[model samples]
Target: MASPTRPGPAVAILLARGGSKGIPGKNLKPVGGLSLVARSVVAARQARSVAAIYVSTDDARIAAEAERYGARVIDRPAAIADDTATSESGWLHALGLIRADHPAVSRLVLLQCTSPFTTGADIDGCLAAMEDRQAACAVTVIEDHSFLWTSGPDGFGKGINHDEAGQRQRRQDLPPTWRESGAIYCVRVADFERVGRRFCGPVALYPVAHPPVEIDTPLDLRLCDMIARSGEDQTTGVADARLRPLKALVMDFDGVHTDDTASVDENGIESVTVSRSDGMGLELLKKSGRFRLLILSKERNPVVSRRAEKLGLECLQAREDKLAVLDEWLSGNGLSWEEVLYVGNDINDAGPMQRAGLGACPRDAHPSVVPLAGWVVPVDGGKGVLRAIADRLLALA
Candidate 1:
């Protein structure tokens, strides 16, 4: 008897085709405040067995989305992107490219963007099944109890699982059958290469309790959105554990509070717009009694002070060196950097953001500041940035 093959590092490949006949731009469609491709990449990142993640696509938007979620992109060819093309061709191309740099990867985990409900645990389960059973491939399946039927050439419906002539059997007495979920597939690299197919040799079925949902039409997309909004399809929590025990919430006024825009009058007086939702968020935080809020701005504009007063937050203005002011204020209040959560949106806020314990920014924040931010809200500034952060903080509280 031969010993079972040990599982090795595996690379997760997510195939996101750019063209969709049923639903246009379906891959980039947002579900639960996250793009479909981004959700898949995040799920893959959560798996411990997955060493790296790669997205194969021909669409520029999909490629950018994949990179935004921290996944390498494999530019798929046009030939393989047509409706007649198959997913296997794209997978083979991606595997070849990945093997060029990561030769140690022995297994391939194929994920579909259509199946948004697939979790990281499902991928790990499939990998475990392949290793424990010593099978060449493992595929996800859902326990299906429906009686199957087929159409004959004579245009008559015939039973495929039971004899139509015999008495109907009880549902409990029916034999167990499984339906392909089309969510996840894990296979040995060597076996896949040998047969050029996902199921080359002995295959194992990994069963999951949740029914798989694939987005193939507009109805499917709307159903997914509804499920996500209902909080039933929430795959992961957006809150970060490192933001706990937060004492102070500091923020830059211009880009962090407003939309990074100012209307200047002929007299050089400027005004900025702020979100009412953001003000409500500040009120909630203040009511929590767990956090002290402050606004630090480089501009000496009275608008900043006025807005800060409206929110009942302490305001510091005309600070050329924001970090110095922040440190001095921390020391004066007997607070440390570890207890502060700073939010900024531009290069001016970069230094201070880095000095804080938890740094965050809006979705439209400057590129340089984004890398420094520990959290990036889904909404832009002056829209719902503060509201989003406040929700996360309140959840922790």
Candidate 2:
């Protein structure tokens, strides 16, 4: 039975392995510009109820990546890491290792990397549901309204959730069914250990708003990427949450402002074209007075300064270490990284982009930076990057 008072904060255990027949190295595969395993860690870290995060993996690369994202790695045995091993085996092994060190951990959370859209809020909701309902387990689920069928032994298709011979019922007439999202699962550690199963007792279902997006094949990966790029309300509520506290908007100059191209005359005069629409968008944001804007450029060209001056935005030029500059600016302006949105289109911007509250990139940005971006604009660099982002953030306000 769930105790009204929780014994302690939950610990999240993520299982990521190396081999995948459907998509090779699936765990490391990037969905929405972040690796599946890394995204899971990010979501776990964001959960206020999660006290510790662990990754159970046999692959060295997965282990390293899990650690890179601030999760402790549990060296899963080669036997259990193979395809034949059930997920329960991995969780039990990881839980034993976790309990050895953190004896006070009573709540156990299992996060799946395949569910790319899982958010910290979802995890917390599941944990809260388990506690509030006094249930032994809670899992994320989504409302399902669909007609199901099954091939009966009589060699005829029969309705599974409804009567085929009876009066046809509207989809809305059917009682709602809860389908597991396979995102977050919270359970009492003792119950799981004793029963050797996730659903050891009464289970609570915590419904999430986002549609289920699980990455198992290449097509799923592509679809997730598109959803992430579109930044839809259904799937991007977590990302939009990051933008809610936005106090500053920092942008990289070259690709973001100039299409990463320049025209040179015989006189060595270089010129670049910018979108007037983007200019208007930035101007509107400036007028709104909600954000402090700055253009950070690796180029020392006077054009960078002139453009910033024209826009009446702060300028930081020729900074190889853009994150260091960003840190100083945040500290000086009394802001945190979680309250800033940084946009970049190249390798140099990757570090700061990942460190910012929401890292965004253009559609045509370099392959390296694309995966590192949290949001990708539909348009290419300099074509309306600022305008697209401006519209989204302003709408949120």
Candidate 3:
């Protein structure tokens, strides 16, 4: 019998250290309502080719946030997590660990938390470029059309892209130049190991349409936040299509159904308040018979099941790995992720939200969760959030 070839690996690696001289806790800083670490992980998860995502971080908080966004955490050594260490150190260490656990890993997609605007399409582009060109590495870049100038020792500006003594030429006449985006890099594992660097053997450039946005200081963070908000405002028309799909609707009970707050008496009994309007909305959705509704909760409290019972909806409670359970449920129910809409309000719900076709959240959802949501209902959690979302989905119907 002929030997079978191993499948090419689809893995992504990210490096995030705790120390940041320019901006303390930089990896955890929110830009677009999501921490940089979470944003990168979500991007990796979005890529159709990516099967495993690993984050190398020494910081406990960064590791927790990365995991919340669907990434495995690699405990980076103190030696490689410091400011002085090059990024290659952390990536090489992570590669070793990832390969040990997943021996089939053949290539790695490296992502940077500083590049908050990086998306799954960018990663996929690099991967495709590498494969199509048979290159060892591929990187994201943007076309640079701006004229370049440099000050000489004689205190005179000199043109670097064109002849200063000859007649001026149109910008379009000049040869195209590409500037590295510093957002995504795809490299063959063997080539990276041999060269001890990202760029090895033949390199390919995957040009991206978006401007290069790198976060290095506080001002950059603020600017990126503004850009994100502007994008959200302009993307409503596209976001509406996410609601048009029908098959299943999954929700987190505590925050999506309640106010994310509860009271406990001296006797140890806990009580929570929910909106009757939300119940009516759920009833209407049930009557439609076009959607499968589920309450997926991490809380072990009995009230979760009680509420689901009253609403006449199926409920799964105390799920530590909501995404895993949700996947199993989807497989059993014969539905695809693209056909379902997920609603959540906190860190724990991030992974499932990113995995679903459409993610919806209450206005007051955690900052990290907000960026993952396709729709942010006007109402806060437990404040008729369900009613508001149901109205929007039904309007499309």
Candidate 4:
């Protein structure tokens, strides 16, 4: 391991091979509203010790995406990118190129694109552990408590840990074990080159309390997508400087405020449920006295007016042209689109969302609006969407 005062910058290398047998183009697939490779790049950017990020891949699309997310691209050779090729070959080749241009680089952090839940803190922790323990490398691991078994040539199962003659032991009495999460690997560059391997000398295991899901098959990807959409993943917090200077907050009424659902009785009466937590969040935002909140809706329903009155916010309903109305309102208030944070859940709201400086949407918003949104809150509409956005704004304040 290197000392804390190591004279060079720590570079992070993310290897994403294009050819995946289990899932084709898996690296480019979206997870948590971000591509797998892009997620790795974003997490790497959050690490304070990582000065530069490089993506090694043979696919041109992956290269373009890596550059789009602020990472240098290394066009890996096909020989080293094949299914049988080990990651060490790609790392060595990429390191060779990086070291040629950056002679002062002292450490290398290898990040896997498959682990979408890996955070910047995890990467920093690995690097910190490496230096603190004076170990040649540090790898992320998770505690494992599963019993082990092995099959003999005769097709008989045998206990790998306990004796077959002994009675089954309690799980708590079993020895502690750890398994690699394949989320992160940090190594001393000099030692790595000298030994031609990641674990050339003493290795340290950095245990992750709750490891993010790893995408290997279609089911894994789907499970991760559901977790992200449900807001169960804790790594969705996005830190953008633009969120700090927000002066106004505009939202759509149907799906942004309500769940875009309504119940009607035979008497032709309609009712919608609204979250009290959302109202409290809005109240807190109003107390800040820094933002002007408004609701823009295309529906001409009294429910919209009633909810607005309860929240003490100005309501504009029966407006088919939300963008035009929003423009007029902004000009009347002596404000510009740059000061507004717009939240929408449908195509109609896309125009205003795109026009606003900071566009956001709820987790279950329309598919078309999700990509255009700068922030996709974890809560659904008529739920805690407003509260989530309000909390994010308050944090920035």
Q: Which stretches of candidate 3 lie over 4 Å from their true place?
A: 1-7, 151-155, 232-254, 262-338, 344-397
The sequence of per-residue lDDT tens digits that candidate 1 reaches over residues 28-130 is 9987677889778877875668988999999999998887665889999999988998888999999999988698888999998888777767788998988
- Candidate 4 all-Cα RMSD: 8.7
Which sections of candidate 1 miss by over 4 Å? 1-10, 45-52, 117-181, 200-212, 231-252, 290-301, 314-361, 366-376
Worst 10 residues of 3 by lDDT: 231-240
- Residues 290-351, candidate 2, lDDT per residue (tens digit)? 99999998879888888888999999998888888888989999999988889998889889
> What TM-score against the true fold does each predicted structure earn?
0.73, 0.74, 0.70, 0.65
Model 2 CA lDDT for position 179: 89
Mind sharing the TM-score for model 4? 0.65
Instruction: Sort the candidates on TM-score, descending order.
Output: 2, 1, 3, 4
For 35-149, candidate 4 gives per-residue lDDT tens digits of: 8887788678767789888999999999988876568899999999998999899999999899776788888999998888877778889988888888889999998877888
TM-score quality measure for candidate 3: 0.70
Q: What overall lDDT goes with each candidate model?
A: 0.83, 0.84, 0.82, 0.84
RMSD of each: 4.9, 5.5, 7.1, 8.7
Looking at model 2, the pairs that clash are 33-371
lDDT of 3 by residue, 209-305 (tens): 6546788989988887787656432112123444667589898988889999999999998999999999999899889887899999897888887
Model 2 lDDT vs. the true structure? 0.84
